[model samples]
Target: MKSSNVFYLVYTLSLLLGLLCVIFVITWSKGYRGGFAWDGSAKMFNWHPVCMVTGLVVIYGNAILVYRLPFTWSSSKLILKLVHATLNLGALSLAVIGLLAAFGFHNKMHIPNLYSMHSWVGFIAVILFGLQWLLGFLCFLLPCTPLWLRAAYRDVHVFFGLCILAMTVASCLSGINEKLIFVLNAPNSTASYKKLPPEAYLANILGVLLLCFSLTIAWMLLKREWQRPNLHASALSDATEPLLTED
Candidate 1:
């Protein structure tokens, strides 16, 4: 198949996988972990997974693909950059709220924070993600940046973006795994994960879908022909062009 055709195919598959992961995670949170709420209950902690999956996993994954999508090719590069920033901002905002929900629940319950592998990995991933966004905004969006430097930074930016996304995915998987183990192995737990309970199936499926989604995205990113036309060489050349002009 042509690269374009393969790209569209993989893009469609990636979206499906991402959507599936989000749905399954939400289902696992609400159905198995108890319904979500804002009160100082386990329900509050529930928002952690919902928001994290919706924001960091799904939205963050989608944000990385904005530049690679074909329809965005005609839009002005500035507009694209703003859209990218906007999406990352949306993701970041949800992630912050998600963290607050988790931490608030923990503090209220007198639970220790940052004790688990999931917490450590998640904290580091979020910090790196924030830094990545700040650097990208300064280097790519700010017109005051030297063209030569922006050109040099662009490749570095893409590389780090991919790395951060991988970290985010790993963080999410570890979190889901940790949640399952805690819930299923609790003293008053509803089901035995060792017995292949329904909740276990749901959580395990969610993790698998997350991996599929990440792999689909990674495949598209690795395909040089699938990258946006002007993204590599020409985008920086026309950096200061007037509004609505393609870079």
Candidate 2:
């Protein structure tokens, strides 16, 4: 099958899975005893945990698959280009689910301290991810011609990839606590909230740490590039060397 077709198929399946999971969770929250809490008051569905685990695996796995596509020449081979495209689309779908589930649990658990910050970060991450996905899809349709145009797309693609990587790292750091406690429907409370252990402090700490690291990395890379008078030809020859020699 064509990459596009495969992409649609996989994306559709993942979407359906997410929708079903959401429906199940919503129903459980509404009808089950105490609602989305870890006090053993609510009845958790058997499939919820399984589905979530599967989804996480798919999400991160797809990320690796997408970023290493053959179209890049350096990492991907022509024969596997279709697979790469499908995986890229699949990865985007998984990212959306990851964002949704992260927020949904946060709200359900009523993690007071992390609520607002998580909302904003999740929103921003989703927006950036959407842009990245669109640009990637466009690259699929656009012909690899007109040297300058192709170069522009390549640059844009790389920018989005870096953005995705950074945002994901940030989001993951922000959800570490939730992953450990809420993921298994484990039982505890934070501040005024009741049920589910209060681990926002840990997640927040991790988030800050990751933010500092990301900013520092960006600063160092930018500083090095800016120090160079001209980033042309021989100046970047070594940088382009690996890309040029890759088969």
**Highest lDDT model number:** 1
State the weakest 10-residue window (summed lDDT) of model 1.
238-247
Shift of residue 2 alpha carbon in model 1, Å: 2.8
Which digits, one per residue and each the tens of the lDDT, describe model 1 over residues 9-110? 999998999888878878887888788888768999998988888888788888988878888787777788788899998988888998999999999899
- What is residue 228's positional error in candidate 2, in angstroms? 24
The TM-scores, one per candidate, come to 0.93, 0.43
lDDT of 1 at 229: 84
- The runs of at least 3 residues in candidate 2 whose Cα sits more than 4 Å from the true structure, single-residue gaps closed, are 1-80, 99-115, 144-147, 178-247
lDDT agreement with native, every candidate: 0.82, 0.43
Regions more than 4 Å wrong, model 1: 235-246
How far off is residue 8 in model 2, in Å? 31
